[model samples]
Target: MSTAAQDHPAAPSPGPRAALAVMAVLAELSFVGASMLAWAPLILLQAIFLGPTVAAVVGVAFVLGTWWVVQPPAPPAPVLLRREQAPALFAALDALRERLDAPPLHGVALVDELNAAARLSGGFLSLVGGRRTLLLGVPLLRLLGPQEALAVIAHELGHFSRHHGRLGHWIYIVRAKWDVYLDSDPAHDSGIDRLRRWIASAFLPRFIRLSMQRSRACEFEADALAARACDATSLVQSLARLELADALMRDGLRTRLHELQAASIRPPAAFWDLVADSLRDEPAARQAATLEAGSRRPARRNDSHPPLADRAGALGEPVAPPSWTDAPCAGESLLGPLWRGTFDGANARWAEQIAPAWRLRHLHLAALRAGPDPADTAIDPLQHTLQRLQADDEIAASEQSLAALRQHAQSQPDDAPAQYALGLALLARERPEGIEQVRVAIRLDRRFAVAGYGAILSQLELHGSEGELSEFTRRRALAAEKLESLDTGLWQHLLKEELAAPPPWARALLLEAIAEDRALDACWVLRTERSNDAGQRFTLNIFVARVCHDLMAADEVDEDLLAARYGSYLRTLFPHNELARVMLRFDTEVFHPPLLERFARLPGCEIRRPTRPINVDVVRIDSL
Candidate 1:
């Protein structure tokens, strides 16, 4: 059978070690075979064809083979923890499980840093064995409140309840053993002999990593469980806050590295590289310094997770995070003014296109700073920073920004930009009066870009029935056609309005237009939002874009499309997805790597595998 494990390249260090081990066993077997063969006429005849040097060569190869087997074994290092100090943690998890009617937890232990993981083995209890303890990091325990911590535990429970842990672990073990038993055979002596031996040993861990990357559904289910165990509000807030902090920390690290690179007394490049390598090698340092893949970026912000804003909206809760700009300052900066000036220039570029009312808002802040007192200046930075934070998708921070804007706008009630900003905040919350508020703002200033854009998008979102969808489609097509002929500034301004749209269909159409103009990056961003998997509409948008634009497809599409396209020949090569029935109705081609894999497994899918990572093709279909 075709297997992914058989195809993977091995880890350099471990592969060589396994290769050596197999060589040792093979060398001993070879010696016995040679001894036996020396008495055989066939082997003796072959030996006679070679010079006396052949014996020396064979003996040298056997000696080298023995050395390979003597190499050290590379097992995963386990982090140990004590029980006595972490009793309260277990008590919390126990309480949570009881409330959720989940099975009793086996044990809880403290890890050194900020992380937690659950291991499940086959038994009456999901968690068992010395290795099965849920390792909670001390920093994380302190970082999250009770409800948030409960949510984390619930996520682990999600793993258990869904049988992900059991199924995944079994797959891991089987794949690992399969590699060791079957792939790393010492018999192959072709040009790819070294590469094959490496792949034979490393197939499992890499596969496990890939599986983990695709575990978003499990993560979301766990988040749902956490919401049930505690509350959605707390979990959303906790995740948002933790992700914000993680982002700032990573930014700090990047800033420090950047500074070092710019310094006059910078260390030799080789020395710095060596230091980085040394840090990576040290277990303790690596544990403390290295961020998990999760902590590296906000989950929803990355390609792997659904869009952060979309996920937050789906949960129907506000995710309030402390803005980095509004964060408390700790140290003096020698180049503070330079950074401030840089920021001013950046804001100025946007200021030119921002509505006049927005310009007035900035002018007002600048005027406040111009007052005699330095305290006024101190407040000005916070005011401007708060306004920036308000523009971002933070509800609580936006409210605080709105208050500042309202205070200024009270003296200038006709300020359309401030009113538009306020409208955005209300619309973000899906407040009852949000539409009226946008209308009020637009009445005062019809040229207000955000207000106009938000109004249209909100209308599309609320009234996508009867004739709205048709009107929207007509308007979008006409707009796309005209964008090329419009002035650069006008086109850019309209495009910004399109980008600001909150509705998925409108955004999809906007991205499609941009992609038609070869704006690949914008297409990628819009395509990322199709991870929701709501219905046929979402699929149609994504599927058409996959053909006409470049973007990554979701797991369901990747897994299902192959069989639906070519399942006739390879009846066995079908992915068992729940959505297969619905997905099969759509016209599909094995255009992407994932889709290609699925299609290749099919007996008769016609598309050939692409040399590049991304592939694109659109198949026409009359129905969903």
Candidate 2:
């Protein structure tokens, strides 16, 4: 939340226009405050008058407010590059920080992605002088020169410039907080919960759009700082390359990367070179690409980023990325040996995690490509698509798709994807029967409900059937509430407030189930119930602790296997079939694992705790 005014010395005070911007932000925050006011008093009053249970909810909410509870964020496939580890890289970074007069970095971590970002760690505490970390992507470093990289770094640092008003700072802070707040448990059925959610859903998204509209100058300010710190040429070139590489990665590299893994095919040793080849469009094409780079779209979502075209124009020219880079990149010059270590280790770790998905794809691909049987009704839609894609046969692909979906729907009417796809296929052919299948899909699974309902609603809207659409839209909104439950403060409050104990039948059922699995340590049952426009929502998050020597190295239990072993029986135990969900998850890393830890600390949260041969030095129940 550090602003330009705080970070930049000798910065001018806000003019009338800037004051109006600050007032606008203050107004947005007031709306949030009003929403909070609706429930916060109730929460406090309940804690004081109701019982200790409500107090627990209040404590969790307060902790969430400070945003300091989720400790030690788990960076995926992280290779922590300390100053000691990469002195040269750190020195360069330090020099850049000094030149920008930015705050001292707490650390730098390298990850395998296509971007670099300046991230404030320790959440809200970071707002009041917390640690800041810079994440450098290997692909980003691999593509740019050191000077260019610094320009990128300077631009990121510019986001923290203190020249802006305090309310402008909240545009970043509260917006990030709002994203997590959105993950609140949808199952919280209280009137207060419903009202709070109504305000958030109806208002916050639009408020975010308005806030972003007001704060675009911050992005321009960041760009200006970058141009001043480095030559405009370096800044411009870096921007162009970053945008191009990102576009290429999103357009095709992701699918290719997955396909290569599935086929056990090693990508080119010079992977960035392969990326560069796809970017080698003619000058005319490049100019067209410039206009379309994350182009100015409607501020419909919470995104605050200005379009690349706008940013480039603000920097005094349009961005035209080069076709090739022959020079030694930032990775070669700045980090040297540090870059070499990441490729084999980081990617290997990533591949290991996704091995199960890869194996499934490999099986399907190998079977179909090696002369698929004519009666192979079990053939995956993706496998068929991949095979036909080679021939560039759109007609064959569409025919195969509809056929595959029809077969799947007939074979397994309960399957959500089959039902959903079949509905889509029918709708594409202008059949009204499609909506029925979509409705069935929505009923079969909440996962399909949101999109399925959307498909139906779109058709209803096109037909000008507002009467039917209104009722259907309500159902879709309810499904949306169910879909979004994790990473929410309200959800955490629900875990503390409502889900203190499992029913006797559920407890006994869970006990009998986990008794047979030797690897299962204990299971924590957290359920949340909410009532709103969605009617009633119920969510069961079962965090299973495994008895193991090394937590990371422990074999992952197949969720379907565990569910098959226990799910049907558990379903039978449910008191009612009111949009209830049971999510069987391992106590793995997540956005707010501390919320789970809070659940564990709750009295009677564990369904059954038994003696396990756990290495005391390693896995701890408290860690959950």
Candidate 3:
């Protein structure tokens, strides 16, 4: 699947350039508005007498506005690889650059996603000759074979060769500057500040809509470049394979997470590495079929790129079919033995980044395993009732299931499973007695994970009912301490020299309790880590990103970098999610408009947002 093209293709039409120029004008106007707001008050007061109180307020406002305008927002840091780190990969990129007549790349970075992009860094100088960084997703690299990889690289590089990267850089800077201007503090109710808000609200959305339209057009042009530079078939195959691989990777991770939780095994540090390996053995045909079935749905209106099928169809016939056996897998060929080492390093970093959440999930699972065993139920009708409670709507159909469980529990007063079922039914009904019933089950049998989970949920409910943040904080700490004490007690019991070996379930329970305690402690620590310093107020973004990393580790793919462009996207769509709510609360109470605007441009990491309002009725009792 080699191509003979040795020079860059003719540049696409200048429509996108014109669109960018308009965006630049809007950005400039925004900057002017911010400057006016920042200095206008101070300048006006200098010419007229004012009270000390009035002067002090205006001075504070001006200083805050100026600071907001001057602070530059940094992009999210990806895992960067210098040329020296992966010589072979850099060599391949250098060769591709030579063929496409593209300028040298500044660096290569890896993101945890299933896509690749080329971005220019710096300001106006960058538009002319900025440092180009290629963000490659390891999963994407692994999915494509050698020829397909080349096609994908060529496509990304095509943007630079055709000057799309340069134009995009200009647009990106202007948009950022506009955000900074629009988001400036509006504490002072001056005319200039009002004008700034008006312009931002009235004009910024239009500019964004136009910019998105141009970006979609640019994507197609880039695809055409790839077709010309590499064999068309390879590009087509790569696109199709990417769609399938992404699906398989997410599904595999989710399935494995369930298994790990069920078995009470702590997720190893190299979890992502394990995920990549699992995908290697999946049947290729099955992935293709999944893609084909999904292709039936229409692409969303706001989709940044054309559908994969459309892109493939646009490429036309290939000069020749890709010879699968002629080359090694793209990742293997490019990085050789270093591929494993690189990904292993990435996995290690990701694992450390998400350690807090990982520990929490482990502990939660342990607490669950230590609770009552539903499988111990000998009454067939009781088991059937439990199944119905799991599958049916809690508010609508749970009454009947609750009645049956209550009857069964009354009959088998000593049965832990029946009692556990009754507790769950009561919790589903939002009754206060649920917590008492769950505790009763734990008294009957301390190894009931479900009962333990129900009790924890009850605590969470009570914590949420607290009227003040200080009260909530105190309760959270106490809860965490209680969990830790349980874990400590278990370890002490196991340390006894004359003690017999614990049963497998008992061993699992101890491990889970430890994990649960660690996770709870981490969550509380993170929730309270928000800073109060004016310069450090934006620290929430970093915290949110860490949470996103953990969610990614948990195999959530819905709000990944590729899916949601930035935090604002997730904030808008999933306001009900706990993470989203956290972000929204911070945005409302702490983040100045400028800081919030900066957040809108950063790469988005999303956790699974709940589809329904987070009420007791919708809470999945079984999944807890």
Q: What is the C-alpha lDDT of each candidate?
A: 0.39, 0.57, 0.53
What's the TM-score of every candidate structure? 0.30, 0.58, 0.54
Better of 2 and 3 by TM-score: 2
Per-residue lDDT over 107-213 for candidate 2, one digit per residue giving the tens place of the 0 to 100 score? 78887777887665443424354456778887777778878888887887765544342345545555564443343555654664565566666656665666666
Q: Per-residue lDDT tens digits of candidate 1, residues 347-456?
A: 34333222222223333333323432443322344334334434332323345655665565455567555565566555654454555566566676543432244355
Give the top-scoring candidate (TM-score). 2
Clashing pairs in 1: 20-68, 20-69, 570-603
Ranking of all predicted structures according to lDDT, beginning with the best and ending with the worst = 2, 3, 1
Give one digit per residue, the lDDT tens place, for model 3 in 1-624.
Answer: 333232334465677668667677666656655665657657567536776677767766766666456436657656678677678888888888886778777778877666888877755435554577898877676667877888898889978876667766666556665553343444444765576667776877677666666666677777777777677777877876666555654344554654554454445666654655655555666665666655553443234577666666556543222223424567777777778876677667666544444454454344343454555342254444443443332323335656766777898898776687677666644466876787677677544533255344554342233233234334334433333333223222322312222223333423333242211111100111122223221111112221223334354433343123233322221111112112211111221334323333332221222222222232122210
Give the CA lDDT, 0 to 100, for residue 567 in model 3: 31
The ten-residue window of minimal lDDT in model 2 covers: 1-10
